[model samples]
Target: MSWVPVAVSLGFAGLTVLACCSFKVFLGVRRFGRELERTKRRLGPKHAALRDELHDLPEPRAARSPGDGVPSV
Candidate 1:
């Protein structure tokens, strides 16, 4: 019965450490997510501009003759 208190104390300490580590990891992930959102926001306008520029470019045509694939009469 004497060892029970020691075991309980050790278990509680272990759990506390585990919880602290988990909370730290959660905070880091949250910070990373916030930074990622900020980056996307900053790039969104540039991405849209580039997309518009691409849309304004002329389309390329195939090099083959128009009647090359037609069947003989």
Candidate 2:
């Protein structure tokens, strides 16, 4: 039973390492989310302007018949 303490200590060390890695992953994801939000905010006005410009464009004229431009006899 003397090896039980050594096993317990190793288990604790493994758990500590897993917890640290999980915390670091959490921090990285949080930072990525913040960057995405910042980029959205920066580009929001340009996106709106482009949408408005697209809406303001005049529609295409209707297609003409093949002989529509010919003069009558």
Candidate 3:
């Protein structure tokens, strides 16, 4: 029938659009992931240093004297 060719053409067109859209999404996700990784790598050392410093700090005590200039809030 004449309608068969039209149906096949429409199906192929839909498939092509779907494929293109999927490819774009995949590429965008890949790019975003790479950017995130790079940012993490850039901040990794600083974060590690901060963690070490926090770990090395002495625990707070309840016997604070005057002139400590530290706020208890």
The candidate that achieves the highest TM-score relative to the unseen native structure: 3
Candidate 2 lDDT tens digits, 1-73: 9999999999999999999999999999999999999999999999999999999999989999878898787
- Cα deviation at 66, candidate 1, in Å, is 18
TM-score of 3: 0.78
Which candidate leads the pack in lDDT? 2
| RMSD values, in order shown | 5.9, 7.0, 5.0
lDDT of 1 by residue, 4-67 (tens): 9999999999999999999999999999999999999999999999999999999987688867
CA lDDT, every prediction? 0.96, 0.98, 0.97
Candidate 3, pairs of clashing residues: none
> Residue-wise lDDT of candidate 3 within 1-73, one digit each (tens)?
9999999999999999999999999999999999999999999999999999999999997976776787777
List pairs with backbone clashes in candidate 1.
Answer: none
**TM per model?**
0.77, 0.74, 0.78
Please give the lDDT score at residue 24 for candidate 3: 100
Order the candidate numbers by TM-score, best to worst.
Answer: 3, 1, 2
> Relative to the unseen true structure, what is the C-alpha lDDT of residue 28 in candidate 2, on a scale of 0 to 100?
100
Model 1 worst lDDT window (10 residues):
61-70
